[model samples]
Target chain A: MKISAQEEYGLRCLVQLAALPDGASLTLPQIAEREGISTANAGKLMWLLNKAGFVHSTRGTKGGYSLQRPAEDIRLSEIIKVLDEDVLNKHCGSYTGVLDSCVHNGDCGIRPVIIGLHALVENALSQITLAQLVGNESSVDAMFHKVHSIHRTVEPHGV
Target chain B: MKISAQEEYGLRCLVQLAALPDGASLTLPQIAEREGISTANAGKLMWLLNKAGFVHSTRGTKGGYSLQRPAEDIRLSEIIKVLDEDVLNKHCGSYTGVLDSCVHNGDCGIRPVIIGLHALVENALSQITLAQLVGNESSVDAMFHKVHSIHRTVEPHGV
Candidate 1:
């Protein structure tokens, strides 16, 4: 599986928000200029994030765009789902085959793996709050290590 | 994130091989005809799988190609990794920025989450053997349940 460029840029946008002072927000022009993406593209991403409730816009001079919830409460899954929902949810059973339909259908073993992988990924994404993304270097390092150690512990054990 | 069409088709081709009788193999033409793909493309995938040791070819008149190892030992991670190695390894620390470079290379919070998710996906993939894809319905159902149960068990506990 591949992370789409849209997901990358959208997440980077959220990171920009997380980096701002507690109450400050970035205007559309400022975001586009800083990100080296065109204004139109930035606007599209903002609209998506906005529609998804991750962000909201203000109308006054002091207003622009800011996160709707605390950074710590925002999940990466939300950001990704907003931008690449279909990509993230491609179940194995849905694969169209070269024939009239997939020959495997309900019998494919890979289906469970894909579905299970999706669930695990969704779990990991939900657990990782935006707060973790804004943490200090040591804290972030600890988070990575925690995940890795868990992976190691899980691999050798069988059901 | 999205699984590439190449990864999907290649895996499907392997499934075709897995479904064959123990000593019987499909030739290049037969494989293409069965999968409804171009012969040249099917040949490319077969060559890659052969080089990777997943399949072997017979050079004689009655020979074609068959699995080199037992299907149960051929992990899905091996297949996905072979097809998506570069994508899987794209780290956040290496992300190019809109500016000359990222402002948070050494300390991005999202880096850990991506890496962790990658590990989890890898772990899940490695757990699934190719034999599962060709299993009976109940066996496949059990595989899905096992993965879900593992996810549930893992979520609340911290190391």
Candidate 2:
């Protein structure tokens, strides 16, 4: 199972917006630079986020994109869904069987098990908001920095 | 995220073995027939399960397979891992450069979020043992039966 770049970029874009001063709008280019994503891809992610009601955008030189609601109100699950990405494996079960030839016929023994997994993930993602992610950036940066330091120490000693 | 057929098949196979009379051995063909899976797939799945120490296979006439440990000792996570299928999404991060280059480094920001999701899923899957799923089959069957009956009743009523 894999989460595509779309979901990752989308969340980062949201977090970037959350990091901006309250009531301030940042253009796609600014977000792209800060988050280390491509301007075009950032724009695409923003368009989808806006369409999903997660953000509001304005056209023209003075206008740009901003959160439609408070950062805390936006759940990671919402972003994932809006990006049309699947964190769980989307096998035949989630599909509307073409020509009505689903192998399991909707009662596949494993369907409930996987669905339970999906629900658990959804619950966890829904609990994390843009506010939480942005607020914790410094901690994340510090952790990555520590990891990088450890890597340097271990690689030089080969221990 | 989606569960692979390997995991789904592996779990069902385990449940089937768990339901067997003590000390009884079941051949791959028998399992394939009962589970409505192809013999080749069943054999492949069983080989992986055996390699993971979940099952022991006998060779020669009347040879078959049996559980290596008690049903209660086998966790769903073990089965999934043995099957080499990830039960949750694991994104490395978003593409920092061109897609081809990103494929090499995989330093996407979303990777961390997905890793967190995987941990939660693994935790849940690890806590559920084969015994729980096997023992709950009766209740699950009853629930499905109820739903089936409801579907039958509603089918004729052109809603």
Candidate 3:
């Protein structure tokens, strides 16, 4: 399975906005340079984020994009939902590329596995705020490690 | 996120083989018809599965395809690995679609979240055997409910 390009890039862009000082904004050009994406792509992402109410734009010289709300209040789950409503639908589509429905649409063995994973992912993302992701890679990595250790102790999945 | 077509079709095809009686096998046509896929596509999927040592094929009119090992011995994790060695790589690719690497390659905040989700998914799939998937949709769905309820109690993620 894989995260969509829009979800990944849009999230990275938000992390950039999250890292900004309070009330500060970034231009599309700056975001493009920092994220290594085309300016047009960055603008597209920012536009979507803006329309989703996760970000607000300012006009004129020195004006740019900033988080609409505090980073601490923006959950990754919310960001993902804004970026792609078809997260699970995209997965289900793989079962029948040419058809609109799957052969096992009524009762699918794979459905439960996919749904369970989705719920777990949603739970994990719900616990993570963009504020948490504002840290550099190692810090964010450490945070996940801590959470995972706690989860392991609680469940002890012997995989 | 999305499961690859190869992974989905390959697993479904394997489930068909798993449901066969002892010493029984199914031809490409039979598999395709049962799964509502094209015969040529079925042949492609079976070829990959056979090459990965998950299934064996016999020649002649009465011969066809069968699992190389018992269904109970085959884990969903193994099936996924056979179908996709670049599963995580594909996700990483989404970060910088145009460039060879990401801007935050050295210290990426998103890396940990993706890695953590991958580990969780792997752990969950590892616990599920192909034999478990041989059941029809509802039985398999029920099985996941039991597992998920146990997981919920053990972890109690509020989300």
Candidate 4:
């Protein structure tokens, strides 16, 4: 399994927006320069985030894009869902062979293992909010560790 | 993130070989038939497995392919490494933008989180051997749960 380029860039741009001051916004050119991506690409990413309700854009000069909600309210899982939905669905259907569904549809050992891993990943992503990522590298790193620690602590034991 | 078709089919094919009696082998047609894939595709997957030393091929009317090592000795991490090395490497390099390396090479919060998640996934894969997947769906599912539970319990807390 691997993270797609769109997901990576989109997340980085989101983190940039999260680090901005309250009510402040970033233009596409500004985001592209800081993130080292093309302005067009940044606009595309922002468009997607906007459509997904993660970000909002204002018109005219002095207007740009900002988070639609508080950074603390936005989860990585939601971002991944918006950016990687097609890829995830394609992954689910890829191993079914030439058939409409998997050959082992009703009884698949591998499927459950994969599904379980997906759940674990989603759980981890859900625990991390954009606010947690809005800091210096060390602080963000620490925040993730803290979030993951609490996540593990409350995991259903022997379930 | 998503699992590639090669990884999926390759793992399923390995599980098929793993379920065989010791010294027993399966022809390309047999594997393809059981997995609902084309014989050519099965042959290609088997070729990769053989090249990676996960399986051995014997050329003869009665001979076919068999596991190179015991199922219990073959971990999922090794399989993924063989199948997805290129994709994983590309994933690492994809988000570096126009620079030769990532702009935040030494101080990237996102990198650490991704790296940490990769380690977590690899650890989980390492804990699961092919033998554990050579059962019915429910039994294999239970095996994964048990393995994951032990894994979580042994995790270094607050580290």
- Individual DockQ of the candidates? 0.36, 0.10, 0.33, 0.27
Candidate 2 lDDT by residue in tens digits, A34-79 = 7777889888889889988999999999889999998777777788
DockQ of prediction 2? 0.10
| lDDT, residue B41, candidate 4 | 99
Write one digit per residue (lDDT tens) for candidate 4, span B72-101.
788888999888865545655633433245
User: Which rank order by DockQ, best down to worst?
Assistant: 1, 3, 4, 2
The segments of candidate 1 whose C-alpha lies over 4 angstroms from its true place after superposition are A33-38, A59-63, A88-103, A137-159, B33-36, B59-63, B90-104, B136-159
Select the stronger candidate by TM-score from 2 and 3.
Answer: 3
> Candidate 4 chain A — worst ten consecutive residues by lDDT sum?
A150-159
TM-score of each candidate?
0.79, 0.65, 0.82, 0.82
Candidate 2, position B120, lDDT: 50
TM-score (C-alpha, index-matched) for candidate 2: 0.65
Least well predicted 10-residue stretch by lDDT in candidate 2 chain B: B150-159
Best by lDDT: 3
Displacement of the residue A59 alpha carbon in candidate 3, Å? 3.1
Model 3, chain B: what is the TM-score?
Answer: 0.80
